[model samples]
Target: MGERAQQIPFYCDGSYLCEPCAELCRTKVQRQKPVKTKAYKFNYQCQCKFMRGGCKLRYQGEEGVVLSEEERSKQKEDYKKYLNEKLLMMAAREVPLNRLNQQQFEFSLESNLENAMLYDDEITRAVALSCIPPEIVDLASNPVQQLKELVNWFKFEFFSWCDKPPCPSCKSDQAVERVGSDTPNAEDREYHASQVEKYLCKNCKTTVRFPRYNHPMKLFETRTGRCGEWANAFTCLCIALGHDARKVLDWTDHVWTEVYLAQWERWVHIDACEPLFDKPLTYEKGWGKELTYCIAFSSKEMVDVSKRYVVDPVLNRMRRDRVNEKWLADTLQQRREALWSMQGDSQAQFLRKRYQIEQGHLDAGSAHKFPSEPFQPRQSGAQ
Candidate 1:
């Protein structure tokens, strides 16, 4: 004869389900009784197949009556408790942006030569810092405020250059070329070169390069340049001020700057290249996001001992030639790695695509396009 089946207790522990014989004597009991009048309510009462003397182990919650209000309330309370604990943990672990900025600022301050030409005097530092538009300064304090400052700075400082300036040679207002945009196009390059060659500076009667590409030209050489030159000079000035500033190469290879602000604890993007009359240049396609110029740095020993011998090779090279793909690719890769490791999602994606193009797996012509400029840095020009 078959052995008799043993009955199992419904509630065991404080919750439910016994341990020793619970697995073998599993069963389900419905709370509501079946109603034949209503089809949906029919067979409301059900039991687990195991309890029905069947080998199969099956249980259904919906087949039974709805949970009681007390049970529902208890479950909701449990969930709320879990969520509150999680929020508290997150709040406690959060790192303030100000802390990060302070750390970076301290780092920069400690890692420089005592008498580097960039910091020859305190006055130069003050001037350079002042030149930093409020937007760049506020990036560390408030990103939204920085963005507002950037828009206004670009509009008033750089964009206003689109207005025709009196020709340096003729002094005739009519000679001003109303270049709609400050972005150097192929035509602009030709015009700029032509103007430099033809127009003599009245103050010195010296022929000047129209679109200055180097510090000497924009600062001490001709003492004047177009918007593009001004943008580059401004970026260099920021870098000289001990700020981690760079010229960003965006769509059309337009120039801009990224400033490491101490208060905001982040690098804030700024465009000082917009011509006075033109709309701010926005990235449309290709050319990645921004390409930064690589500055050659010598060791302290070399900088000190060979300061005179270490001619301004990089500067001279940058003035006449466009940067090559190999150098750009390597520099971009370094920047990407640094950014990605820091959890910069958007910047990482942009760099990855640019890296693929630089490696020749993708054609930049099809994948990237930039504004026309004749004065790109050339590898051959490197001293």
Candidate 2:
């Protein structure tokens, strides 16, 4: 039964891997080379796809198959057709998306405005300013690292407010398991849908509900979730810190965050669950699992950053499915331009800095140093 199940590619679909199975998933490509595959989703489900059917988790499968020139031509043609169709589909949906976008923008920018409002007030404003790091301007130090530290601070101190919502009736430590049912809200149609965490209190028999809120600020108040809630809360906090941080969604059933560290001129990966910062290789190297795609989104832009997550883009590109790469690129660029048009000249400079980073990844000729932070050579190396 286990072997049969393994044949079907789960593709990081809320699966958990035990340690032995996780290690097994980390197949050795060559004795000298290290493993690069992630095998766990928290402590619950295993994402182990050890040489099964094209190991959908890592995009690792069927080693010897090679496409002919004719087949390559067909793929190129298909990709182009896909891009065209996708463009049309996007265009058709823009009106509805625009409405949704406006709805989002209304409640969204309020957070920014509220911060500014707090700044405008004399007393509350001063209190908020107290959290600003005094050493933030020290260019000698990596601001990216500082921002990461800031994220860790928020993760530990602010957003992850409690482990889980305490049982309302009795404040019991024992978790009430899912005996579920709840009314769906507007967020189900607007953003993402989540299973309502309904738990019946063992002690008092009172029902407790944890509605998956899509709003970042609301999440800040609620603050207890798996990766999804943490990512949302942390992204909001990053924005609160006056940085271009984003919620990075991995189609592999995981969500994390990325912050655009101006010091390094690249996005630094941060996962609040593991409470990790700038450790992109934690999954690839430590967990020994491969990733397919991690698309980062913001109010201003969206970019496919799978290249920034792995050691070899070519090897791991196999994990990407359901969409053509060209289509993906074109779609992301279109989204950026659309959002950019809305911002006008206000954010031109910020967008340009961000665009340059995106463009760097697009240039096929350049070597991709996967998931590696740019290194600074010591100034007095030979001195």
Top model number, lDDT: 2
lDDT of 2 by residue, 227-330 (tens): 66667766655565566777776655567788776766667777766667776766665544557777777777776777666665544554454455555566
Question: Candidate 2, after superposition: displacement of residue 268 in Å?
Answer: 1.7
- The candidate 1 region of ten consecutive residues with least summed lDDT is 300-309
Model 2 score (lDDT): 0.54
In order, candidate lDDTs are 0.36, 0.54
Candidate 1, which segments miss by more than 4 Å at Cα? 1-124, 130-140, 143-147, 157-165, 176-197, 200-213, 216-227, 236-243, 250-252, 260-268, 275-281, 285-383
Provide backbone clash counts, one per model. 16, 13
Model 1: per-residue lDDT, tens digit, 1-383?
02122222233222222111233332334233222222121211123232323212222223444657786676557645654454444333323335454454334222321112233235555665566665487565564454455446644553334223456566654534433223444654432332322333455443322342333122322324444444555554555445555443322234445554556443344545431111112322112122222221211110101111112222222221233434433543454465455546775575455434433512222212323233223211100
Top model number, TM-score: 2
